[model samples]
Target: MSPPDRKEAEVRRMLDGPHPLVPPGLGLRAAVRGRRLLLWRRRLGLAGWLLFLAAVAFTVWAVTQQPWIPPPSRTTPPLEGW
Candidate 1:
């Protein structure tokens, strides 16, 4: 049989067997864990967005300020033949 057919037959055979017993609290535990995972994911997403905004703000400041260029001279040069 083809690989797909073999996989389907194997799945059917497994389904025909008796199911295993699950713990009574499994669903409750799973729900709690799922909620925690969602909260953690949301926190991480917010942190990522905050970081991205900070980077964008820094870039804008850098572009506008042009920190790489030196500032203008504070004093005038010596007057020639005063």
Candidate 2:
């Protein structure tokens, strides 16, 4: 037989066989796992936003205080020809 005929015969054989079996409670387990994953994803997104906000707040505080710049001296410079 040609390729097409062979394929058709294989398909007919498969169709004539009994249906495949599935384990009980598989759908319930899948749904529960899906829900848990969605909740975890939501929590991660919230955490990312919180970290971003904290970084922005810290940057603003640092810029305003500018602790890296040294304080000016209190005393005046000595006279050149005193």
Candidate 3:
């Protein structure tokens, strides 16, 4: 039989007549298919690339950001003994 028919049979067997747990056009092997897609994308170097660069840039900017307090406060001492 064709792939879709085979998948339908397997899905039917999995659900034991189908109630509501299965999504449309998805079978019991959806997780396997999803993992395959993720692997293919990773192999093609198409995963989280933009996110990686954005994270690196954010780190650098955060490291170089000026301190919250002003320069005068940096060396000022407490007035406890005054």
Candidate 4:
């Protein structure tokens, strides 16, 4: 094709915008939508994150709140001192 025709075609393509899911379209939209759906389903993602945090907190609390216990060897007699 002629130079002018080619340039015109290029400009037209640039202005035509991209196709979705199959061509040069905004794939980011799909990703964003997926994220939004996830957030929506999970109640704005905050609840999910808070739940995760709560699980971690519960685990830590359970571990740390336990009473201390000495080693078995320390609590046991040393074989009647040989």
The candidate maximizing TM-score is 1
Error of 1 at 41 (Å): 0.8
Query: In model 1, what lDDT does residue 13 have?
Result: 94
Query: Each model's TM-score?
Result: 0.73, 0.65, 0.29, 0.31
Predicted candidate 4 versus true structure: per-residue lDDT over 29-74, tens digit per residue: 8889999898798895788899999999988987987646553564
Residue-wise lDDT of candidate 2 within 1-82, one digit each (tens)? 5466888899999999998888999999999999999999999999999999999999999999888999898999988996
Model 1, which residues run further than 4 Å from truth?
1-14, 79-82
For model 2 the local lDDT of residue 57 reads 95
* Cα lDDT listed for each candidate: 0.97, 0.94, 0.76, 0.79
Please give the range of 10 consecutive residues that has the lowest summed lDDT in model 4.
Answer: 69-78
Task: List clashing residue pairs in candidate 3.
Answer: none
Candidate 3's residue-wise lDDT over 1-82, tens digit each? 5467788789889888657765676764787899999999896675578778889998888678855545564566767966
Native-to-model Cα distance after best TM-score fit, residue 80 in candidate 4, in Å: 23
Lowest-lDDT window of 10 residues in candidate 3? 66-75
